[model samples]
Target: FNDGRIQQLAPPEDLYERPENGFVAQFIGENNTLEGTVETIGEGNCTVRLGDGSVIDALPVNVSRAGERTLLSIRPERAEFNLDRLPEGTHTVKAEVLEFIYMGDIFRVRLRIAGNENFVIKCRNAVGQRRLRPGEVIDVGWLPQDCRALEAA
Candidate 1:
């Protein structure tokens, strides 16, 4: 609830999978929020023009038409650095690796993308996983459905 008003009420899975607005999206878990403007709207998806003038496809969750400001929400774990692992038609953005922390079971990778220096991506500690280094540039991609375009906060 925001400011003593109910924002959304649903099961735990539903709350995380589908947030109603920016508030719910942020309150639920760790999310990478990118501020952008809607460039074009399509069936079940839309293209967002980021501050860097790059366009990315995203699922319109709370955004309506073109020209509307939106905050694209993506989970760090949902983002993939390996293009081969990502599905076809996924739009990729350049990300600079700022820091890499090796956790017990997961590696926390901090990246800078679209002018957001705090953006992060989590990679599981497994075989065949590539180790990221600071100052390294890489392409990050995620499925459009995994990125939710919510109302600007």
Candidate 2:
């Protein structure tokens, strides 16, 4: 917390995969977390309605009900940018390329999604796409298993 009155303890993967609260989720890594409402829950999955009315499928962690508030966190490395074409029903969303931080192979893709300006999706420049321009809308997404739904703080 910015107040610095809190602390959490967890192993690496659990800290990253199943954050206990919004604070932990944001603190652990480079992540894009959005507040959402749970729409449904199943055996090992759940559907969350995001801010822009984009219903996203995610792996349930801290939420388990139809009307519960949850914070969804997705790491940049888990997302794919501008795939030639994705199969039907993939968890894709439209995001504008905000900025590109060039690394030798892996580059950071900052994006604006659903009017939120703090999203990012990192990719390998060695792959097909090497350039991304600011303000260019592109399709970006990750597997459902890679998206985590955590308890809203």
Q: Estimate each model's TM-score.
A: 0.97, 0.84
How high is the lDDT of residue 132 in model 2?
87
| Per-residue lDDT of model 2, residues 1-153, tens digit only | 447665467788987776766777778887888778999998789998888988888999878789999888888888887564445677777888888889887888788887678888887777567588897888887778888888887
* Clash count list over all predictions: 0, 0
Per-residue lDDT value at 94 in model 1 = 93
Report lDDT (Cα) of residue 145, candidate 2: 83
lDDT by residue for model 1 (54-113), tens: 789999988899999999999898999989998787899999999999998999999999
Q: What is candidate 1's TM-score against the reference? A: 0.97
lDDT of 2 at 134: 93
State model 1's lDDT. Answer: 0.92
For model 2, give the RMSD to the true fold.
2.7
lDDT of 1 at 106: 96
Q: Between which residue pairs do clashes occur in model 2?
A: none
Local accuracy by lDDT, each model: 0.92, 0.81
